[model samples]
Target: MARAILLRQLTLGPRSRLQLERKLRDRNVPMEVAAALLDRFEDVGLVDDAEFARMWVRGRGEAKSLGRSALRRELNEKGITGDLAEEALEELTPDAEEESARRLLARRVRPFDRTDPAARDKELRRLVGLLARKGHSPGSAFRLAAQVIDADSGDNVLEQRPY
Candidate 1:
């Protein structure tokens, strides 16, 4: 019965072996039974934290525009181990981070009226807040926003802004 539930969970989504064990415990499945089921799943390649970590890094890095810091934190929260997390994070490059930041900035830049000082400040603040929540650092969020807002400029765009 516990194995059936475990199989169902796997069918729904990829799960780390540890996460499955924890959930099985919550369901009041006997420890021995849960361990046995997990072992069986591992043997059949149904539960693979390594593959899960890899896919997670790829998906979140591409879709959500998350950097290594954000990706590592999320994977750790999901029970990924340190070594595997490092390997996965190593696969992401600075270009990936920049691209994600660029995409986010393009969408967020319009809210600020570039012609008005106060409006620009307000928009920069709002954009900064949005990027911060998305897991970018202060320097990265502000710098990327500047680059996106002034793609053709030689001057520092943030300095020209009122705020």
Candidate 2:
């Protein structure tokens, strides 16, 4: 029964062993059965936490522009922890994160193009907040936001001297 349940779940999508164990628990499967089934699944490569973590990190990072911190939190929530999660996160380099942040900021600030200073400032704050929620540092968010806004405005606001 546990095997059937596990196979059915796997047919739907890849799941972490922890998630499968929880599902077994929720279904009232005996702990011993759950453990045996999980071990077998692992043996057969049907339940690989490391591969799941890697795929989760890649998919979420690309689809949501999530940073390392956010990705770590997500992996933890999905019952992926410790070295596997760290290894997956290591796949995302600092440059890749910064590039994702830049893309996020660029998309977010698109509507504010040609707006006045006050409105642009307001939008900038919102964009920074979005980045913050995605687990980016404030400094990185602000720098990226400024760079995107400057590029959109066709002026290097940071480089201009006030008359």
Candidate 3:
């Protein structure tokens, strides 16, 4: 029954060893049995945390535009940590993260004209807050939001603040 449970979980989707262990535990599988089952799955190349983290980062980045900070937290929650999480996070380069942030802001932020200083400031704050909640650093969020707003207003101002 334990083996059947593990197989059924795996067939549904890839799982980290820890996730599988939790599943077995929830089903009242014995500790020793769960450990042995997980060990065998690892030995047979089924329960790989590294691969799981990689795929997770890739999928989430494409689908959700999650920043590295958010990805790290998610990986840690899934029992993918240390080298595996860091290695997977390395795929999202600084440039890629900035691009993702820009893309996210583009979708949500409307263009603000240079004539309306009050409205532009409000919009900037809103965009910065949105990016901050999504795990982007404050400096990058503010700068990126400013750049997008500037570009939209035809000023083409470059924000060169050190992040």
- Ranking by lDDT, best first? 3, 2, 1
TM-score against truth, every candidate:
0.85, 0.88, 0.88
On the 0 to 100 scale, the lDDT of residue 80 in model 2 is 89
Better of 1 and 2 by TM-score: 2
Cα shift from native, residue 142, model 2 (Å): 1.1
Tens-digit per-residue lDDT, 6-59, candidate 2: 999999999999899999999999999899889988998999999999999888
Candidate 1 regions exceeding 4 Å error are 152-163
Candidate 3 residue 156 C-alpha distance from true site, Å = 13
**Residue clash pairs of candidate 2:** none
lDDT of each: 0.78, 0.83, 0.84
lDDT of 3 by residue, 60-125 (tens): 876787888988998898899899899999988887788777777777877565689998899999
Give the runs in model 2 whose Cα sits over 4 Å from its true position. Answer: 113-115, 153-163
Residue pairs clashing in model 3 are: none
Number of colliding residue pairs in each model: 0, 0, 0
Clash list (residue pairs), candidate 1: none
